[model samples]
Target: METISIQWSLVLFTALTGIAGWTFVCVAADEFLGRAKAAAFPAGIAAFVLAVVGGLASVTHLSHPDRIMGALGHPTSGIFTEAVLVGLLCVFVAVYLVMLKRGASDGARKVVAVIGAVFGVLISFMAGESYMMSSRPAWDTLLLPLGYMLTAMPGGVACYLVVVAAKAKDAQVGEYAKALLVAGVLAAIGAVAFAAAAGQADGAALGCVVAAAVLAGVVPAVCGALLPKKPQQLMALAAGSLACAAVGIVCYRCLMWMVSEPVANLFLNIL
Candidate 1:
């Protein structure tokens, strides 16, 4: 049996990027739907910074970080697609921020937000697709990558709500509460579906995946339903939701290795 040895760098990359990407989409929702604009600028900055850090962590996994951009030359590779998507995410975020600073039209900003939201969401999917392999039964499915993307949304919504509550007084977040609940349910369904796809080969792997599903899905759903109106309490709920999402994401990474040999180690051997 292969041991469960998760890659810390990849963990950080996936978790951070997932959160960042989802947060951006939430922020974009605020822009497109015309919600609380007070936290929009700072929230966008937070998402952008988180993504940059996650991108850096992703490169750390490679022996030749300096040549990482060469990935773009191999368009057929999932990794190459992921790299390009992340780049597009950064570019979109930067342009959106710049337009905000220069007082661009609402229509123009919404256009940027629409584009940014698409790239932001897709990066997580590509990240999971990059890791897909036939050797690992758990990894060889669309559900895993879809789980990666769906599971990330609750975290993103929580992070965005945190900023909204923290930065604004008496912030109105009833609509956001609904978003959190929806994200949580989707996350739960996705996680469990992925685990089910694995066909119960091991106790530990199934345990991790199932537990992650509950944590990532149930907590946010409950919190969102009972979301406090007070700013501080709302912040607390949001923080807790984000933490649960993080734990779920990291556990999924552990599940990847628990079910099969360390794929990263295989690459390292080749190098």
Candidate 2:
């Protein structure tokens, strides 16, 4: 039997960073929009911790500090671009969190929030773009990056929901539910684009993609919708949404690897 393998570090890095960094985006929305102002500080801290943890996981495969520095020097490399973007995301988030703690003016924190949101989006796209290569035809597509950005939103936003929903009013919870539904739609588009790109993907891989959309996308949206009705079940619903996001993300990434195909050996084909 062929042992299917993947870049485990890359997978973890992409999923974790996407989720954690995006969580910051949601936290920023709460602060900027004044939906959950009080929750912003605590939620921001959660996002920072998770983002840092994910950043550390990405370093596991780097092996040496020199190799990391070398990669950073090459702006042409996708790894370099992704690393820079994620780093900026962490920096902005840290600044925003500190400003919140220091009781800085909203203008300062808002500036950081806007900057961090931009980085969050860029890093999400780059997470998948870094995987694209001429050698791997299956990995090269605009849709892959879009999928990375979109599917990640559900999980990332779900993290914020987990932290903020308890004190959030019914109307506020409804707004979050609406956001989840939108994320679900985006997930559908991105995940389907992923399946469409894999011309030779097996049924198993396709099935997993469908499952991912539901777990990472549909289930969370549904939970958010129900949360307004079940006001007392805040923690349970929020956690379930986050859990689904994590599992769905892993499932999607794993199936993506299973369907990967290198371009046919051109030299051998010509023989």
Candidate 3:
């Protein structure tokens, strides 16, 4: 039997979109919490741009990109549902930024923020669900969505801290960054444990997975947690940490693509 294969284009697109969604969730959370106003515009715009790029890159995965519009009409399909959630998230972030620019009421902005956060998480959940292919044993576990959430949100929060620190230079943001780092460490650990529980990976694949987890979770957590208290140091540290975390996420996704074994057990496995 033939083993299932990974799709790099889809993987890249999902990583970009996943990060974009999580970034918006972080922005919205900050907005609602009233902790960082200056960070909103830049972060929101960044998220929107990421979403656009990912949405476009995803077309490469489709044999008929021109026919992609029909995806919007089918809410029942996981891909369609994920697409809709992504679109809604981008819209909400865009609208929130516009409202901010126009000096809209806090109440109005809060409403949009809440909406954006919801859609962000829903997108993450859908991302995992989208991979629930019965043909690929490794990708079929329920832990997939939880793993996505665990990694994406922490990555997103780190991205937000980088943006905010760069633009705002607010020392107070350090505390929040620290909290996020701790959360990220915990989430990353949880994700790794969950993946182990699935019992799909072995040997070098497992080693790579663990190493990717460290790069994604431990490195960023330590960097974020140990960020210098000075405002000037914060920006550089946060940005570097964010970049590291991103590489980790990409590694994780690549491994996910690499580890699948076909359910059929016919011909040789792809990995």
Residue 193 error, candidate 1, Å: 1.2
- Order the candidate numbers by lDDT, best to worst: 1, 2, 3
Candidate 3 all-Cα RMSD: 3.8
lDDT of 1 by residue, 111-210 (tens): 8988988998998777888877776666788987898888888988998988887786466788889999999999889888877787664688877887
- Residue 213 accuracy (lDDT) in model 2: 81
Arranged by TM-score, best first: 1, 2, 3
Model 3, residue 40: C-alpha shift (Å): 0.7
- RMSD (CA, angstroms), candidate 2: 4.5
- Indicate which candidate wins on TM-score: 1
TM-score of 3: 0.88
lDDT of each: 0.81, 0.76, 0.72
Q: lDDT at 120 for candidate 1?
A: 87
- State every prediction's TM-score relative to the real structure: 0.92, 0.89, 0.88
Q: Across residues 27-66, which tens digit of lDDT does each residue of candidate 2 receive?
A: 7776657777767877777777877777777777565744
Where does the lowest 10-residue lDDT sum fall in candidate 1?
A: 262-271
lDDT score for residue 258 of model 1 = 71
Instruction: Candidate 3: count the clashes.
Output: 2
Q: Which residue ranges in model 1 land beyond 4 Å of their true spot? A: 228-232, 261-265, 269-271
Q: 2 or 3, which is superior by TM-score?
A: 2
Model 3 pairs whose backbones collide = 1-266, 1-267
